[model samples]
Target: MSENIGDLFQEVMAIKQAGEFELISALIPYAGLVGLELIKENAGLITILRNKPSNIGNTTIPAVHGGVVGALLEHAGIMHIICECDTTRFPKIINISIDYLRPCLGTMDTYARGYVIKQGKRVTNVRIEAWQSDPSRPVAAAHAHFLMG
Candidate 1:
């Protein structure tokens, strides 16, 4: 099953189209569970996490779970690598550090985008930011390192 996942990832990476990119979240069960969607804009690709009742962590404030936000940051970084980098295999995460700046409202969708800081032979560094209502005010930001073997 893992081998099949690897093959699917490689195939998707080879195509690298907007529609084909959407298959990535579907390929990973956890991503599907979290309702992650990929969108391609004039600037670049962006990720959206559709809010659902299951994702709500704070009932009083109705905020999104911290873990879900972290997952979005990590996934955004990986998606950026897959779309921008020349690689045959899926990148393995080395370490990820995230900062939650504001509460992500659970009533609306969350958007995230990643930028590649540096791409080395075996490691890639990416920065991701997630926002709910406005792009200027980010709800969370993250830095991640992936081992692209």
Candidate 2:
């Protein structure tokens, strides 16, 4: 039998404390979501922020959409909080909050890193930053609270 994709992905996850955003991106449905490199540090942290070609019909001024950025943060947060707890299962997200700091410019993709500030029996708190072209300048930031199921 062929090796399982989940098994392969899990193997990939085991190797890199920092996940492969490109591979992860492939699994994500959003095609516009380009996987940028990690900009910050802290274990179990994951961030996906990036710019894609202006489809023109999507948004104003050809910038990344807020919804995509929000979804990225949510995904990053889930990846992060779960890393903090090596349980027999993946943590579920009750909800997430993302605040846009600025409009992401340039043709480059932005990346965010989410670190767990708190992980308890019921919930987890994550903080993430989204930046592009330069990590020093972040286009958006988010603090997410995830309810562990």
- Scored by lDDT, the top model is 1
**What is candidate 2's lDDT per residue for 1-149, written digit by digit as tens?**
36456664465366444544344445444533344333234443546454556422245555676777776677667666544565435566676667878776535566766777887777777787777767678778788776675
Task: Write the residue-wise lDDT of candidate 1 on 12-98 in tens digits.
Answer: 865585446776676678888988989877798899999988998999899999999999999899998988888868899999999
lDDT of 2: 0.61
Best by TM-score: 1
TM-score of each: 0.92, 0.67
Q: Model 2: clashing residue pairs?
A: 47-112, 49-110, 50-110
Point out where model 1 deviates above 4 Å: 2-6, 17-19
Candidate 1: residue pairs that collide: none
CA lDDT of each prediction against the hidden true structure: 0.89, 0.61
